[model samples]
Target: MKRLSLLLAGALLLQLQASEPSVFGAGNLDSDSPYGLTESEKKIVENRQNLKNTKRKSQENSAQLQSLRERIDGLQTIIEGLAEKTQENKLKVTELTSGEDIGAQRDAKIAALEEAVRADEANIASLKSLLESMATQVDAINANYVSKDEFNALVGEINAFKRDLGKTLKSVSAPAAGASLESKSSKELAAEAKASYNKLYFKDAIPMYEELIRRNYKPAYAHFMIGEMWHYRKEWSKALSYFKESAARSSKTSFMPTLMLHSAECMMHTGDSANAKKFLRSLIAKYPASGEAAEAERLLNTL
Candidate 1:
């Protein structure tokens, strides 16, 4: 009976041992096996999953960084373009301001030229009147039954005077407005006229000088020449008219003394002795240091 009891206990112990797994067995919860895993294995699997997630996040962050970098680059390019455009606009503003200043200067110059033109027109009208009076006088002389040689000489002088007068008239009428004067440069034209006058080609010089006087109204030298030309032709009334005009026109110039002396001479030729003496006295009183005053004193002594 004791033996059977011991056997039964042993059998029960064996059976429990067979049913329960050892800690190192393949089926044990703490063992690593194909069907069942250990805690370390599970931890390794979780680490691997975490590594995959980290890799995916890193790739996504890299893409976002690259996108941000591209945007920054694009913004920098736009900024550079804007800076260039701003610089160009500033340059344009400066250019426009300079252009406006030039325009104002041109307008002022044009105004001065226009005033000169008006003076020239007045002188031209006076010259034309003198020419008409001379023509009438020549016609009267021709009607007095003169010799052929005298008539021919008188006609030749008259025709030559007419030609010169026509040239002067044409020159005064050439330029219409300020633009014409500016384009042709009034200063240059005046210089050219003076050069021609110095050559003593009075017929050629007359037109250019008249043009200069038309462009610059203060050319007293031009007026003096016209008076001298009429005086040389012995057209007494015409000569006196031009000399008086020259004297008045020279008031705005440096030739006032010369103009006054010539005007007195014209008065003397026109047989106005009283007026001539009066002008001579005035010349002496006003211009004591002038050559004209000395000449006046001599003339008074002779009278």
Candidate 2:
């Protein structure tokens, strides 16, 4: 038992010597034990180092994800701003196009109106020329045929016929209350006569005007118009007679200055220079600011 005990103690001392390092800073005493650790302890240290590397990698991945999210948010905001700007551009384009269309329409309307005004002016000029031609043709026709005495007789017969018609119309259609039959008839006759004269229907116009004169209504103007017709025919003696009568009855009318001028021209045509000069001087004295006064001054100088 003492020898067995001694063998066990020797085994224990060898184990302790193998576990401890030398005090001279030498390596492990036992060559079979690497780094003086057991196999299980080395395995545990390798597992702990592996866990730390995995944690560091995970933290880096998280930071990268946060940066990507911020970049995506900035890009989205930029896209939204671009969309708003595009809409504003579309509205501006629409307004400009609408204004251009309205201006084009307005210009077209103005052009059409101007064209119509030009057409109306042309039509009025054509009518005036046609009227003047008709007047000349009537004067030529009258001078070619119809003696003065026969024409006068025809006018008298027409006047008689008109008087008979007037009486019949008065009986057929009575005048309304407060209406003057005679005045209305005279006005109607005057309008018809003037219209006939304007249309160059002298044969129809003369008798109607004469009838009005016979009724003692607006006789001065009728006489003056008759004198104008005779003057157009170069009947100097008849023109002078009518002109004198017009002047006599034109005291309350606006036709006196014109009638006086006509009378002066008639006297000159009849080779009465002395009377022409005296009449022209009288016109100048009475109506110095009139167009007739200017003509009289020129004629008197020539005489």
Instruction: Please give the TM-score that candidate 2 achieves against the real structure.
Output: 0.39
Clash totals in order: 0, 0
TM-score versus the correct structure, for each prediction: 0.36, 0.39
Per-residue lDDT of 85 in model 1: 44
Report clash pairs, candidate 1. none
Model 1 bad stretches (over 4 Å) = 1-183, 219-221, 232-236, 250-252
Error of 1 at 55 (Å): 99
lDDT of model 1 at position 229: 52
Q: What is candidate 1's lDDT per residue for 74-165, written digit by digit as tens? A: 33233333434444444554555557556766666555555555554555465456555655655554454324352354355454544554
Q: In candidate 2, residue 213 scores what lDDT?
A: 84
Q: Which regions of candidate 2 are displaced past 4 Å? A: 1-184
Angstrom error of the Cα, residue 13, model 2: value is 99
Expressed as tens digits, the lDDT of each residue in 120-229 for candidate 2 is 44543454344334334434433443233434433333333323322322322233322342455888888877754543334446677777788878888888877865
Q: Give the top-scoring candidate (lDDT).
A: 2
